[model samples]
Target: MSAGEPGTGVRARPRLTVVSGPSGVGKSTVVAELRRMDPTVFFSVSMTTRNQRPGEIDGAHYHFVDRARFDELAGRGEFLEWAEYAGNCYGTPRQPVLDALASGKPAILEIELQGARQVRVAMPEAQLVMLVPPSWETLVGRLTGRGTEDPEVVRHRLAVAEKELDAQGEFDALVVNTDVKQAAAELLTLMTGTAVRKPWSSS
Candidate 1:
């Protein structure tokens, strides 16, 4: 039975699902699809010091901030977990997640493996779901297909992907994102209790 099944005499706890995977493994695409499928689900927008890529919205893709501001926030302990990847800083704010959970809403966070580990430390109840590519070659193709970053940045991410894949055992569940629609459907079931029906209602 799921955690919130009725008649179990157990109070339901809001789920904090941390969706993590190697860079370029379609984490954002799968997440965007999840949002499209279920708008009510809350996804934590992380704060980043990296420049926004083309087609990325300031507050949507991430809370893009300057290095100084990011450093200040980190120093002030405003973030739940923070990490520097490929020379850019990324972190999840603590308050919004806590507020979402307090309100009995399922919260989702898309972050790197390191940040996911930190989140695990802070919120042991949080469900860590790892989204993985079908194959290593598939990962390389996805990373190169973006054509957004420098060759060196791509290489660095590729190297990190190796370690990320090796650490998949750390996550509570593994969702292979070979198809965005299918993967998103699986993720929606994890976030909510229901599967992807035609109407897509969480009620």
Candidate 2:
């Protein structure tokens, strides 16, 4: 939405919301559930310089690019927010999100904490939601059960997650993801200002 029209006093609706949490906290799963419940919501896809993993599609999961191209885009100020993670750079394209918002669709960004903070500064009206694990033990279990990384890597992730958990107070909404359905219901309530649906859609 554009700024208030000059001398018209017409206010614009805030349309962007950011969701962030520690790694392996099921941010992706929660967001996927939100999309399933509401097909109209526009989720922002991020760009990254990392190699694509199995079952990931470019432009859908992420806009995979080379480091040089990512740097070029960053230098051109085309990104709303950008950050380095695990030696790879990731960023959100500015225009697409604005376009989606301008069309009256709510734009949801699932990003890391650093990028979320950058979005907050750039768009103060954007809502920020923190998705947190139900407990430390649950978080550790989720991280370790992935079987994707070594023990050392899991330990490092847990350390980083501890810091992320402390930043929950900085968010506008805190959703505890003990149950995916319940957590998705809570998140949808925050996004749409509606009561959590009973018998939330499973199809």
Candidate 3:
């Protein structure tokens, strides 16, 4: 898909939707569900310097680049938005997302708060959606329950979550992820600009 061409059966220009949240807020799970329900949505696969986790397939899950390559791309301004998280660099490549949108495919980006802000500045037309947990305690429980990180790391993530929650008003919409099915449905409605009412409105 290239810029300026509409995808099959899509007459309008595609929009770029950014999905961001604190770590361990079930963003991945929610996004997975969205993709399962609608495979036509173009989900941008980020390039990351972090090690690949189990069950994560390269090119499908992430680009999985090394630090050197990641730095090279960042230096050359190849990314639409990029940020460092937990010492690892993660970024969305510019060309692919542009191409997807140009081809009239709805593009979704799952990235961090900083990266989301960058996209907001660079692409003002992009829709910014924030996924929030039901509560702080619930967020902590979900993070710890994942068992993927050390206790110290979990603690750090929770701290970050607190800060992220405070920034909820910055997004175009906020969907509380207390129920995965409900939240996913809300997200779908948000992306499609349907009639469903969002829990939090854009400021």
Candidate 4:
């Protein structure tokens, strides 16, 4: 399909999908599965100062950069949205996402709640989606199950999750991440503005 031209079954304007949620709600899992199911969906790689975890590639997972470089980019107005979390700075570059959307490819941004809110203000047309767990207990289980954080860290994340959940109304839609397959499918549907089982009424 040509850029900005609707096809028989495809959307015209490229979709900008902002997926945000608490740290442990499986946002990454849903995004990974979406990319696997539809490779054409462009997933924007973020720039971060945090050290790479196991199995995370430099450019593929994130654009690993030093604090100085990150500051330089930020000064140049390179990031669409950025924030500091847990003593590390993370941000999304502006150019790549704009280019992808210009080329008629759906761009997916898996970011934090604050970043998502920033994008909503900057790009009103972008679709905002929040991934939620089935329940509080489930969310806590997923967070601790990762085995990547200590008790203090887990508690902090849960506290943050509670606040994030309270901001669900700010998003255009909310997809419960109880079932990975189902959530991914719903996300794809939201990105395309196509019909799937209605998760929540969009505001």
In terms of lDDT, the best-performing candidate is: 4
- Using TM-score as the measure, name the better of candidate 1 and candidate 3: 3
Q: Number of clashing pairs, model 1? A: 0
Candidate 2 vs candidate 4: the TM-score winner is 4
Q: Compared with the true structure, what per-residue lDDT tens digits does model 4 show for residues 1-203?
A: 33433334545466689999998888999999999889999999999999999999999989999999999999998998999988999999999999998887999999999999989987887888999999999988888888977899899889999999999988888999989999999998778754233355372
Best by TM-score: 4
Q: Order the candidate numbers by TM-score, best to worst.
A: 4, 2, 3, 1
lDDT of 2 by residue, 1-203 (tens): 23433344443353688999999999999999999988888989999999999999999999999999999999998898999977999999999999998887878999989899999998877889999988999999999998989899999999999999999877887899989889988887677663222243242
lDDT comparison, 1 vs 2, better candidate: 1
Clashes of each: 0, 0, 0, 0
Q: Which regions in candidate 1 have their CA more than 4 angstroms from the true location? A: 1-12, 51-56, 145-154, 194-203
lDDT of 2: 0.86
Candidate 2's displacement at residue 138, Å, is 1.2
Whole-model alpha-carbon lDDT for candidate 3: 0.84
Which TM-score value belongs to model 3? 0.82
Residue 92, model 2: Cα distance from true site in angstroms: 0.5
Give RMSD (Å) of candidate 2 vs. truth.
Answer: 8.0
- The C-alpha TM-scores of every prediction are 0.80, 0.84, 0.82, 0.85
Q: Poorest 10 consecutive residues of model 1 by lDDT? A: 194-203
* Model 3 misplaced stretches (Cα beyond 4 Å): 1-13, 51-55, 146-150, 194-203
List residue ranges in candidate 4 displaced over 4 A: 1-12, 52-55, 146-148, 194-203
RMSD of 1: 6.4
